[model samples]
Target: MKIAPDVVRAFTPTGKLRASINTGNPILAAADATHGARGVSVDLARGFAQRLGVELELLVFDTAIKSVEAVTQEQADIGFFAIDPKRGEGIHFTAAYVLIEGCYAVRNDSPIQANEQVDRPGTRVVVGKGSAYDLFLTRELKQATILRAPSSQAVVEMFLDQGAEVAAGVKQQLEADVLPLGNLRLLPGRFMVIQQAMGCPRSRGAEAAAALASYVEEMKRSGFVAEALQRHGITGAAVAPAA
Candidate 1:
């Protein structure tokens, strides 16, 4: 894994690897009182910086779209994102290094008990604004009215606030949100599985993107990705298969 000098420059034009971290997705990153941000994304950023032979500067964001914007605008060198075609326009994504499930949750009194029941004419689904689920359900769900919250962490709360029929997001997130409230329950299965990957600005050149893709593959193959997930106490997310 010898990194070329030009490839290093592509990731560290400012002599520091600026990794855009989004805390909106708790599975990827979260704000910690002891530290500014911590999660699997932070560990991966640190690992990438170590390999690039540069200092690491984490640019914290509260939403996926914001994080994507930082990389796409070239303000940051790399970012963690759920791969989506709309975002592929400005960024080059590696094969997913992590896979997380997306599911629906609803009030116990609600009649919805299965994934298929969520797309009916009267059902209103609340999802995070500009998230993978937001983009996904927008395209996949034809009848359900889509409502957006400020962030993924806020989706369930927003759903409750609006008295929406359903809440949609990461399964872990939905579980964490509905656990304390006795009234909400998750649907039988997931609506989608998110392919979370590292990405760089497309302007960084194919060589740079390829180098990143290779780095992620190595991380997966060497068990670094799996170990990180365990270390973070993150469950319901699986390390993706090698390229």
Candidate 2:
């Protein structure tokens, strides 16, 4: 996709593409062994810079909230985020490029054997603050109490520490985090599907947003998204369908 000059200027005003990459979403992004951000989100951001013919400056953060804040606060030009109504207030989102499973997990002996059983009046569900799962559950769960963790990476520990009856987050993250401990198990199936997309601050105008959205669609149609997931060895996430 050829990025228009006006859209290019809007996205890269400082002659460099400033991208806010969230390392907390392990399904789409994570810190490498060397601590640099890696995975599909990083690859897409770098690819976007190449398409725009600009230098790429990465502003890495540990959570989606921080990443969204970077763009909305004008500290960065663009960010990768899960497209949600709450986050859409200040950001213009592209069509979703990936779909991640969001599920509930419980202790092995907990009574919450299914996804539908998680929303009891007294059931406490722990989620990463400012994450897609957190936002979705906050809206969908009317009865259950949601305990917020500092970040998605800490949700598992927080669930155990706070004695939350259920933990909600990316299914891949919950499984990996629980692998070392034998007492927890993921509820069968997912409660929600997170739609991961690229976004720019709404102040950047429709042209910039449209440009980025087109790029996302092209990437999906060309199988770039699917290839990126495989190349990164990312599992449990699927490429989103065409909009």
Candidate 3:
């Protein structure tokens, strides 16, 4: 696909592709002491920059909310995030390139044996603030109380500190975070599947959105996404199907 000159300018007015990367989500990216950041999203950012024939500058943030803010506010040219209507207000998202499960976890002795048991009255479910799970549960849960953590990485600790009955977030994250804090078991199945996608500020216009969206679709079709996940040793996330 031929990228129009204006579209390239929209993405790189400063002559570099500024990519907002959220290190909080773990499944997509994380703080790498030696490299600044690393993960599937980082790999994709590199790929997109190369495709646009520009330098890649990673603007890393610790939480999804911050990452989304950077892109929506146009502080960065693009970002990787879960697809949500609230976020869509200022960003145009590509169809998902990776799918992650949103699961519930409880103390091993807690009576929350299944996903169905989580929304009971008096049950307090802790989630990362402004996270995809938090946004989701806030709407779907009619009875359970939603406790917001400072960041997705802190959900497990907050759950423990507050004695919340359930902790909710990316399945892989929950699994790894709960390892040291043993006696936690993930409830059977998932509550939602997160659609991880690439997005650009809506002000970038439809052409830029189409270009980024097309790039993502090709990445999925070429097995680049699946390979990146495997190379990073990321588990419990699947390459999204064709749109």
Candidate 4:
């Protein structure tokens, strides 16, 4: 079936929303490039389009920062990123649909097991630029020397390469790839709890935000949201009640 251009353009100038996918994260990877549109985010976007009786188009970007810029520049209707209040000035966020725990990735043999260990002098913590993890580490770990990487994967790589004592990112991503690297282990506690949300251009107004918010609520109530998470091996991240 042909999707209506008007429906597709609801979030973008050209009737297409560019969805950003993190190839480094397995769950998001499954939703975008790896699964060829079969991943959870893709499914959610499709559901959003279907519920609105519109056609949807997906545009993929390599990084979350790029994705946020896409929406801010009006090149895409919406994008997904970990929700942070600091980013609110640049875009409108729908009700968050997923909860993620931000934690540290350490070498497997490292003695660091708790948050306290991360605060000790000489601890080198790596984090991605502009990520929620970066913000958390910057504010919370007073004594550690924080190293900023360009991307989540790069932070993990830096830790593995011995550039830093720890890397910080979402728990699921660490569990999927970083933990198995033999030298890496996720610390016991989360540094910050993050809610993953959809972002729209700030200029879109309250009505568009309400429509997206309502659609997310419907998806959660219908059990589709949970199913999507489960299909992607994302556990414990609950869909929040729509605003």
The regions of model 1 sitting more than 4 angstroms off are none
Better of 1 and 4 by lDDT: 1
**TM-score for each predicted model, relative to the true structure:** 0.98, 0.97, 0.98, 0.85
Report the lDDT tens digits of candidate 2 across residue range 94-152. Answer: 99999989988899999778888888899999999999888899899999999999999
Ranking by lDDT: 3, 1, 2, 4
lDDT (Cα, tens digit) per residue for candidate 4, span 1-243: 233444345655554445554444444545344545555667777767665555677766556676677777777776677776666887888777777788777877788888777888898888877776776677777888988778776778777676677888878877766746676777887878787777677887766676676666677788887788887777746676655
Error of 4 at 42 (Å): 1.1
**Candidate 3 whole-model C-alpha lDDT, 0 to 1:** 0.93
Each candidate: RMSD: 0.9, 1.2, 0.9, 3.4
Q: Show the lowest summed lDDT stretch of 10 residues, model 2.
A: 27-36
- Supply candidate 2's per-residue lDDT for 234: 89
What alpha-carbon RMSD in Å does predicted model 3 have with respect to the real structure? 0.9
What TM value does model 3 have? Answer: 0.98
Residue 33, candidate 3: alpha-carbon lDDT: 92
Clash count for each candidate, listed in order shown: 0, 0, 0, 5
Report residue 63 deviation for candidate 4 (angstroms). 2.0
Per-residue lDDT, model 1, residue 30, is 88
- The TM-score measured for candidate 4 stands at 0.85
How far does residue 23 in candidate 3 sit from its true spot (Å)? Answer: 0.8
For candidate 4, the per-residue lDDT at 124 reads 89
lDDT per residue as tens, model 1, 1-243: 999999998888899999999998878988876767999899999999999999999999999989999999999999999999999999999999999999999888888889998899989999999999999999999999999999888998899889899999999888988999988888887999999999999999999999999999999999999998999899889999988
Each model's lDDT = 0.93, 0.90, 0.93, 0.70
